[model samples]
Target: MSAAAVPAPLPLSYDDVVKNLEDLPSLPAVVMELLNSIDQEDVDISVLAKKVSNDQALTAKTLRLANSSLYGLQIKVTTIQQAITYLGFQTTRNLITAAAVTGCFAEGRCRGFDHRAFWRHSIATAACAKVLARQMRFNQDYAFTAGLLHDIGRLVLVASFPERYEQALAYRAEHDCFMLDAERAVLGIDHVEAGMALAEHWNFSDTMRLAIGGHHDPEKPGAGFLAAIIHVADAVVHALDLAQAPDGLVPPVSPVAWNALGLDEAVYLQLFRETELQYEEITMALLS
Candidate 1:
């Protein structure tokens, strides 16, 4: 049903939801261990690889990703250690995070949620963000993760309160508005707030927190470069119609985010093309 004649979504307070949001799509422990392992000194790649390989599903996905054109490895690596040896530790960690996050969600109960489309958009945005970061000599892994999970709060809401999220989706379709607007209108909290709460819940790093929490608000006092990068990546992805969102709503680009890129129009055209290429390879690898 279209949003036009839809009844208002049942009310739910953002605070109350956040307070009880502990059970939303828990990340596998391997991700947390890997993240925690990175912060310590003299960490052995073997140990880290073992942690990831322990989960057979995660290992297979991670291996497939390491071989994707997105990683562009020279030789076919058969195992996780070989992957770490060639791609380096940070890239390996990024691979695991991508696999784990993508694997966490069930088929959410929201009937029209378009789970496949949502991930396609997320992967496209992540690819776009990585291109931006590489050109800027910034952290590609952080940008990739942020863009990959930028809309995670929406996933959390869909998983936890499918009926309410369905209402927000209807509202978005009816009004032909941005998802954030429809979400706030119906759910009383948008994904940004929900994402920040989730990020904190998962003990995300500062860059991650900025990416998830400030992607839509890059002008926030401490939003930082990653936030702006994610913001621009998200806009570029949607503007290119990568999301295939029925409403076709592109979020307004923050001027601060847009101007920070300092790239020429020609560069953006290249980025758009490059993003689509990597997205096709990577999404196939991850989602297949």
Candidate 2:
């Protein structure tokens, strides 16, 4: 049957969907606590380290990532404090967030979704965004974070509504259509909405939430600078086939988004090379 012939997903209220997702994997307590304490002036490295250290496994994972070649630390970090110090507050916070978020959905649950490949695409998009941000003279850190989480709502849907999500996946496969389109047709709401819901629950910054919500449709009103970066970054990642699902069709770049960056083809070639290099290194460091 043509995917177009597939019946649209029954309308599910956003609140009901959120409630159904309560059983999905959640961010670690330490990560949540750290997020809560992010704004305190005195939430020193020691306090953060102690919280992470409380979870021995999480600390070990964090330390492993800290020492990985991705960070390029000259000296090895032996403790959570040392890792935090070496990586700095903001980078450390981002690392914690990445680890916590990635760890939650590492195990592939929903059929038809390529869990590892999806994360690879996500990391590649983040790498692309960071590189693009550098070329455009924007905040690389924020770009990377937003790029990494841009498609998180898809994960939320797959994890929370496995059976229904599977049906959406089937539609995409049968029709050879974009996953976002399949999701919208089958779920009545796309990953962007689902991701925004989860982002709100997690208290993500407004900038980050906007990026997630507006990544696919950057031309939407109120879409910020970061949203445009991620929008382009996602397209670039797809162009290179860095990481993606089986039917991960590359979407076209928005002219508005492209014009906002003011980058030329030469910059894109550089980004492609950099994304390939960073994607391999970071994926090994974090997932290996």
TM-score winner: 1
Q: For model 1, give the 10-residue run with minimal summed lDDT.
A: 8-17
Candidate 2 vs. true structure, TM-score: 0.91
Tell me model 2's lDDT, rounded to 2 decimals. Answer: 0.82
Give a tens-digit lDDT track for model 2, residues 1-288: 545676645666688668866776778877887767656777766776788878776776677767766577999987877876777777777777876787787455787778888889998898899899889899777888898899999898888888888889998989999988898788787898899999988878888999999998899999999999999999989988877458658898999999999988888888899889888877875676
Off by over 4 Å in 1: 1-11
How accurate locally is residue 233 in candidate 1, as Cα lDDT from 0 to 100? 95
Q: Can you list the residue pairs that collide in candidate 1?
A: none
- Model 2 lDDT-worst window of ten: 1-10
TM-score of each: 0.93, 0.91
Q: Give the Å shift of residue 260 in candidate 1.
A: 1.1
Estimate the Cα RMSD of every predicted model relative to the unseen true structure: 3.6, 3.5
All models: lDDT? 0.86, 0.82
Positional deviation of 44 in candidate 1, in angstroms? 3.2
